[model samples]
Target: MVFIRWFLGKCILLINALTLPKPMLRIKADQDKVDKKTQFFTLYQFEACPFCVKVRRFIRKNSLKIDLKDAKNNMANKSELVNNGGKHKVPCLKIEKLNEKTMWLYESDAIIAFLAKETELS
Candidate 1:
């Protein structure tokens, strides 16, 4: 059962890699805006997670530059997710606002929507 699950996960990852969407063209003004918005955002994810793949695809398709933190093998990142976010959830996004306030966002759909809305202004 473990082997089957691992194999299926690998297959899903392979499919995702093979069908990556082309990134959107970023205009100078839009890029600048996006850069600012993404500068403080970090995405915590595991490489093989389907939800993470969805969020990653959205980031790539929209040409967003948010930093990705791999929590699978990285102890520090994993701990950060648990300690700060209150749980070690894949596809969690850490958003830091200009006011020095931090927001830990979970769930892939909500993260994608928030990112899309933020970038739409650019």
Candidate 2:
């Protein structure tokens, strides 16, 4: 079972690398503004999870530069996901606003939708 999972993970990564999507082009000022907004977001994910990959592909294709925290291999990240985020789930998005409470968003489709709405980059 472990070997199968490892093999599938490697295959998924290879496919992701080969079919990497190109980012959409934006004016310098517009892109800068988007970057500023993305700085407050962090994605907690496992490198090989298919759902995580889906969110990552959308992020890359839209040129969103959100931070990625590996919740699988990194113990600290795993703990944070479980404790603060209230769940151990991949593709979880952590949104930190200056005066608002932090938001922990889960599920790949929901994450993608939220990102699309927030960044206007779907």
Q: How close is candidate 2 to the true structure, as a TM-score?
A: 0.96
Can you write out model 2's per-residue Cα lDDT over 1-122, one digit (the tens) per residue? 99999999999999999999999899998898889889999999999999999999999999999999999999999999899999997889999999899999999999999988888733
Local distance difference test, per candidate?
0.92, 0.94
The local lDDT score (0 to 100) that residue 14 gets in candidate 2 is: 100
Provide the lowest-lDDT 10-residue window in model 2.
Answer: 113-122
In model 1, which regions exceed 4 Å deviation? Answer: none
lDDT of 2 at 106: 95
lDDT, residue 95, model 2: 97
Residue-wise C-alpha lDDT for candidate 1, range 15-62, written one tens digit per residue: 998999999897798788888879989999999889999999999998
Top lDDT: which candidate number?
A: 2
Q: Assess the local accuracy of residue 34 in candidate 1 as a C-alpha lDDT between 0 and 100.
A: 83
Q: Candidate 2, which segments miss by more than 4 Å at Cα?
A: none
Error (Å) of candidate 2 at residue 104 is 0.3
